[model samples]
Target: MMIYTIRASRPDEWRAQRTLRLEALKDPAGSVAFVNTYETEEAFADEVWQQRAETQSFIAEDEVGERVANVAVLVESGEEFEEPQTHLVGVYVRPEFRGGGLAAELLGAAIEWSWELPEKVGRVRLWVHEDNHRAQAFYTRLGFVRTGRTMPFPLDESRTEYEMVLERP
Candidate 1:
């Protein structure tokens, strides 16, 4: 097993972040795991990635310093929801690192960051593709429960994405 270090991403590490994101978009499960495509993300300017890195983004790097996993917490606020919520997004782990508890580590990083935010975040939520049973099971193991709310998958309207939440304790 390869040793991995999990840490927050620096804004200047946009290149590394972009590379890993593109790699994740190419995964076999990428179709349902992510809403962005390699082509679309590849066209983003360096500054765009830099701004993304500044957000609550965390990455797991291998011994060789390759980013093997990533997750981000996005703060969402509007009249649509009762209170502002922290959303877990862009979660991905390289195939070689799967089933090694890296996913849980990534999520823990995001949740920790969420609790430290200046604004009071009521809960942490994530959307899992209804067809992605592996991801659903993984989230459940991490204490996320289905909210019985779903939205159409942006990439495929015929499919659905279920909303899962972990209430703030």
Candidate 2:
């Protein structure tokens, strides 16, 4: 296993973000977790990257400086009774890095980032494939509990996702 480093992503690394995202989308398990296709991710504009990096995004890089994972934690402002929250998205660690604690590290980093927001995010949430036991276990180990929230995943008709959340300390 290679020793990898993780950091908050930068606007200039949008291309790297695009590349790693596509690679992650190509993974067999990715089809269930992500809705974006390779081409769609690859085509994201620089403006999108700039806004994301400045506010909420992180990336994992290999020893040689290539991006291998990209995770984003975005906050959605709430209107009446909406209950503002932070959402976890674009979480992908290269297949090669699986089982090396990279996913947990990514989630921890995102959690840490959300805690630093001045508004103080109350909860962090994400949608995970209903049938993905591997992911469910991983998330459970990290303190995410099923909210009993279910919705049809946008990308696949046969799959459903459960909303899970971890509250801020």
| Predicted structure with the largest TM-score when compared to the true one | 1
Q: What is the lDDT of residue 98 in candidate 2?
A: 86
| C-alpha lDDT of residue 130 in model 2 | 81
Q: Which ten contiguous residues of candidate 1 have the minimum total lDDT? A: 112-121
lDDT of candidates 1 onward, in order: 0.91, 0.82
In model 1, the Cα lDDT at residue 162 comes to 98
Instruction: Record all residue pairs in model 1 with backbone atoms less than 3 Å apart, i.e. clashing.
Output: none
lDDT of 1 by residue, 92-133 (tens): 999999998999998998998887777778899999998899
Q: Candidate 2 residues 13-44, lDDT tens each?
A: 76677667778888888877787776776677
For model 1, what is the alpha-carbon lDDT of residue 111? Answer: 90
